[model samples]
Target: MGRINGENRDVVFEELWKLKIPAKSSVFAWRLIKDRLPKKLNLRRGQVVVNGTLCPFCSNNEEEAAHLFFNCSKILPLWWESLSWINIVIELPQNPRDHFLQHGNGNVGGIKSTRWKCW
Candidate 1:
């Protein structure tokens, strides 16, 4: 995956808005990506050894980016709400990165701060 910084950041953020993923600020976008990663993958969560760490949102499996952002029931409602707030009606991407990178050209002035906070 590419770093969301410099010109790449602009490209990603603009693409995200175009994709109707939500017009949140770049900081919020970064946080959303971080939140999507599995707890095990997050070094800040501490080391994972012996029994595998499970996803906090879904105990059924490890909390990888795909699971947390795309598959977790806990996060689905948030995703739906985010899209709805932006008046975006479309199918979500299968991968978290793809979802984050989606871009659409619709008017995105309706995006809300709460949506970013939720991320």
Candidate 2:
């Protein structure tokens, strides 16, 4: 998807669509990059009643995309382990789009790069 207001397409989105992933996975990434997932905070903002906004895993703060995927104590380790398996040792970006872009743009080449991006 391009800009909602008819501006130039975002590079992140352009790169996102080129990934050799399933359509559903690509759509999920698009929603994640746009911060449009129906996480608790987003649901509340959309006027959908939520019992509690706290993250289901940690319950330490309002459930938002950033916290759920990046900052959550329970989930962050999984990210680390996944990265480590691929020999990546860099600090993770806090924003989901940044994280995706970083992982998708690894220094490897061709199939390896695509595989890392997919991974």
Candidate 3:
């Protein structure tokens, strides 16, 4: 029913509205959506020196953006609980782009969608 289900993610690069958030967080979300974040898994794969690919927050599983944000045992419940405060419960997507797109799906280009994308 929305952009969340779309496969053509090149459009993600066009959404400058997300940059309205603080620059650091905006850049982080940008890297995250593009799957370009230097998570431990990516660093190791790129031949960077990392002791392990484990999630630092959980000490379990490889550290990918999806794992860092949504799938970590420590972060997962916190996300669910925080969103519930605003009555926004969701089953977070494992794919990073889809995860951001799910948040951006509502109200399309408005600040609400942009803020979610930047978060």
Model 3: pairs clashing at backbone N, Cα or C within 3 Å:
none
For each candidate, what TM-score against the reference?
Answer: 0.50, 0.87, 0.76
Q: Can you rank all candidates by TM-score, best first?
A: 2, 3, 1
Please report, in order, the local distance difference test score of every candidate based on alpha carbons.
0.58, 0.82, 0.76
lDDT of candidate 3 at residue 113, scale 0 to 100: 66
Q: After superposition, how far is residue 92 of candidate 3 from its true place, in Å?
A: 0.5
* Candidate No. with top TM-score: 2
**What 10-residue stretch in candidate 1 is worst by lDDT?**
104-113
Q: Number of clashing residue pairs in every model?
A: 7, 0, 0
TM-score of 1: 0.50
lDDT of 3 by residue, 1-119 (tens): 45586655476666633366676766776787778988888888889999988889989888888888889999988888878766776788887778766776776777666656665
lDDT of 2 at 113: 66
Candidate 1: where is the Cα deviation over 4 Å?
A: 1-38, 41-51, 105-119
Candidate 1, residues 55-101: lDDT per residue as tens digits? 78778877577776677888888878877876767777776555654
Task: Determine the backbone clash count of candidate 1.
Answer: 7
lDDT of 2 by residue, 1-119 (tens): 35676577687788778888899999988998899999988889899999999999998988989889888999989988987887778887888888877865656446766776676
